[model samples]
Target: MTSAPDMTGRTLLQVIPKLKGGGAERTTLEVGAAFVRAGGTSLVVSSGGGMVEELEQGGSEHIAMPVESKNPLLLAQNARDLADLVKERGVNIIHARSRAPAWSAFFAARRTGTPFVTTYHGTYGAKTAIKRRYNSVMVRGDAVIANSAFTAQHVRKQYEGLPYFDGSRMVTIPRGADLERFDPASVGEERIRPFSLRFGEGFKVVMPGRFTGWKGQGVLIEAARLFREERPDVPLRVLMAGRMDEKPDYVDGLRRRIAEAGLQGVVELMPATDDVPALLAASDVVVSASTDPEAFGRVAIEASAMGKPVIATAHGGSLETVLDGETGYLVPPGDAEALAKALGKLHALGAEGRRAMGERGTQHAGQKFTIEAMTTSTLLVYERLLGQKG
Candidate 1:
């Protein structure tokens, strides 16, 4: 790994669409805090959202802008504005997290001769040439950061022969959890009590992600039904927790499926919570049923960090993060039958056996996926890029 340079007194600017509760936004904040700790000025440019205050409190300045605009004219204007900011702030590096803002940031960095960096946080759709071109901005960074080895491979295969593509420039830096916060010992019974009461005293299965089709809420619901049908005597409940408002129709469809399956009480759709670690502490098992590939599965890592067993699809970043049958289980994507069988295996483990699995997961997560490790790797990328420029 490249070493982190002395970033003291340097200015680093990160651009994202909004300071919301997504992995990208969280990573931006984590890196920004690291920048502050290294005695650098950290600035984040976003439309501003729930995490803005948190960003500011962590010694990072928030610059509100229309960087989210997809309008061509607005994007061009944003480029000019960002160029101005780059020059004025003497920004040493411009790191972009989202595609729309990355386009603007790319141009601004080029105009000012500032080092440009981008994190490919998602597996963006590029069925069309125009869409591919738009998505390519993420890889245009002087140093393109891939959140996982899976994501890095995806980028390489997707844009293999492009003139701008450079395999050596792609860096894999996985997303991480705050181990201190996610530690089971740190989360008290008080934090887990309310969720435990709501979920009731049974084997609790949790799938934490936004309410989207790709998240496989429907699959989990079906799996719950199948599991119940196979073992009618087994006490179990499935909790689907995430921001359901983004996709009301999807949520409605899921609720309808749950009702049709006679799983009204067995499957619950709850809003996304601020206390994911607490919920993980309360859960017997954590699930990531993403039908689509995740660039990096943060939920799986978080569950592992919390000393909870995870059951995720055997694809995407989950393949990289999960140790099949060791830390957790992995079934085929969207296979409710396979998922139910996996769940059965976990249930057969009993409390003590499952606790042993969780302990192994916790140890693995602490070594591989801590926020400190992620931030340090990121800073090394920044330092290397800036050092080359200097």
Candidate 2:
């Protein structure tokens, strides 16, 4: 949206837990590439995953490390090792994404006397003193980036009256969707065909996220059953697709819920896929049903970007992203009846009304949220810190 501050001859190191398919990981890659494009040397340190190739392709170097480990011993060791790296690489500014890596980066930057920046990527639970202390590393930087305004508020409130509270340092930059990848026109028929063949001709709804309890996968299951009861004629099929590797017990519990609710035919737990855009393309309405308020819900934004009408719970960033009765509907969080009603409303709108809503969403997402826009805003944060260093 604005001219990116030049990164000429600067070396920026971004530390994250992993290069996985999450908003934090995506933002790390986006900013890393932007830094490189603006003439900076970009280095990403993480437990490498599927996105490593793409990061390399963007002219950034991948330094594989166990930064994702939450073990205290490894964290201390990582700090010492990273401190050495900062000195050897002559790192201009080091930024961190997750808490564990932020702790490592914090000590590393302090040890090397390097400028440290951190992004508050999630609204982590801090019910106890120890957990609050553990989460504090994210705010221990010269500059702290909050992925959304909602998150910025959380940071201010969480650390308020505490020693590290500095409201001035917190910056709100909303996460952006990659418009080019999410473009409906760019999505080919072949990409949507397989999904269509597999899950054909129902009111296809896809909730793309992990099988986490808070993500509201179980909520969606209940909503699906209710919708099926309300409208027996309409085949309501939902695909809860995301990283299904962790939390086997939670997964099993959800499977039981689906079975008990008789949502076996209505809902499917699809495994994570790299082609999220293709999955979005195949669905009619995208759902983001986080039982708790998300700091910023990228699902709603990305779904809107793909010219798809969305149905997300009403709270947090979804309030900002989804315009009620315009781009999509926002039912109350954890309210299965409300969610079911919203689902029925979208289907009742028919193809043309849904398409119109989707078209408006595409325009909204393109204007308000795109990777270029997010990248530029984040680079400015780096530039501001680098300029201070100068």
Candidate 3:
């Protein structure tokens, strides 16, 4: 493992649209905490949300700004404000985690002669030249960080012909799960009791992510119907747990589908919860049935860290995170029948076999995706960019 560098007396600034519950927001907090741990001054700029208090608790300072606005004048003004902040705070490096804020941060860094870094957290849509140009700011960093190898490949392919684009600058740093929190041993019956009451007696299958069509909640519902038909004697329950406010129509559609399939009692849609580790611990099997590719599958890693078998779509980052038939199973993306088959295989494993799979998954997660490894790698990138040593 690489040692973290001496970041004492240096200041690092991270910019994101908001302090939300997305992967990028979580990474921002993790990196900020890492910076403070190394004795460096850590600062974050965002529109502000639920995570502000948590970020501050990690010994990082937060500046509230309207970085989420896409208005051209607002963005340009933000750039000027950021440049002032950079100079005033003696910020050594500026890191951007979202597209809108990246544009502003890129200009600010150039204006202040500070090293700039960016983490491409998504496979951004580039349907037109204008869209591609807008997305280009994410790759303009001195060191471009990608959440996964799959994301790095997407970046290279998307900007293949740009004369100034250097693919070699892109680095893959897989997102990590908090092993201390997600450990099965840490989540006891007391924590799992509430969910167990709701789940009742049966094998619990959990699909957790924000409610969206691409998340494949409908696909999972169809698969649940199939699973019930094939094994009438076996008891099973499916929970679609996530926030539904973003797409109320989609949530309504899912409810209709669940009712049409006669899975009203068997399948339930629940709101997102803060206690994800406990939920996964209570689950018999966790699923990530996305119709589209994920930049990196954090849910899969989190579930694996909790020592639970995950059934994820066989595309995107899941291909990199999950070891098929070992830690968990990977079914064809969007294939309801294939998902049903995979669920059946896990059900047949029974308690002992499933427990063994979970153990392997836990070990794999510790070796490859712990938060310590991720923070160390990311700090190394900052150290290299600034020509600093431990």
Candidate 4:
């Protein structure tokens, strides 16, 4: 990252609904620490979660509040509270990472005359006018940062005719993989050994994400079943790891499918893990089978960075990150047959061929999707807005 911009007395207060294990939450902490390292006071406003301690340890203060509430009354109340906090703590800029919190942060910035910034983290579905208006808060920021080029384009298309919408204010900044943790050189056998034993020497493939309907964990299970049918001679093991508690019914559905398809031992639904990079390192290949488009699929790039061949759905951010026939293969969204076919193709490549593809993917992620690059780009946006305010 270029020279840390001089942010000596400035303060960056990032507001989000929760301090949790998601892309937005992770980015919130990463950017806060970068702000601190650049000689600024960094504060986060959220309902505390497991990551709060980590945030504090990195020199960012965490303020517990009800910013996650979507109730109209609570939004106004949160805005008042945030405005007061901004004045009390001398918060230079308020960056919101979610819709509900963005509403509060927007008014707080207005009330306190502090620069308001936002990151568009999801492709919010807006089937009605009310929903569209509700989603509009993100674009209202003095600067709106989209996590991927696909997201930037979507935002521009969706919000172009809005009265105050200025496309220039939006920028594309991809979510980054934490290289320090994901570095292959740093991950020793001790870390990989446990997972290695559990999944065994079979061609281990892992899909790590929240076990939601749209995440397509079921699709992956189906693909695994089909792959076993097609390549019965080959040993196939699939690990679908995520927070199954959030969607018990869906998880049950996946479990039933795995059992009925006779993929009980071949496919396993493990709990969410903190050490995803190690899981990627332990596996022969990684998979991103999201039926819906990912705003920015961090897992695909993270797997690539770990020298594992990735097979991701050929849509959204995956298109930009995964180079078909090079870094990884991209299959049609929700097409189990195509996904299974891609897996077979990877197996055909043999060990050395897969390694070469993974090497290219590592280079691709190292050059483009990196933690330092993401943090540095974000700091630039903050400093630019601060410069404007002066």
Among these predicted structures, which one has the highest lDDT? Answer: 3
TM-scores of all models? 0.98, 0.97, 0.98, 0.98
- Please state the error at residue 46 of candidate 4 in Å: 0.2
Question: What shift in Å separates residue 333 of candidate 4 from its native position after superposition?
Answer: 0.3
Q: Which ranking of candidates, highest lDDT first?
A: 3, 1, 4, 2
Residue 334, candidate 3: alpha-carbon lDDT? 92
User: Candidate 1's residue-wise lDDT over 134-248, tens digit each?
Assistant: 8999888899999999999999989999998877889998898888888888999999998898789788999899999999999999999999999999888889999988989
The TM-score that candidate 3 achieves is: 0.98
Each model's lDDT:
0.91, 0.89, 0.93, 0.91
> Worst ten-residue run, lDDT, model 2?
193-202
Question: After superposition, which runs of candidate 4 have C-alpha atoms over 4 Å from their true positions?
Answer: none
lDDT by residue for model 4 (2-29), tens? 7668778999999999987788989998
In model 4, the worst 10-residue window by lDDT is 1-10
Q: What's the lDDT for residue 73 in model 3? A: 97
Residue pairs in candidate 2 whose N, alpha carbon or C atoms collide under 3 angstroms: none
Give the least accurate 10-residue stretch of model 3, judged by summed lDDT: 381-390
Identify the runs in model 1 with alpha carbons over 4 angstroms from their true place: 1-4
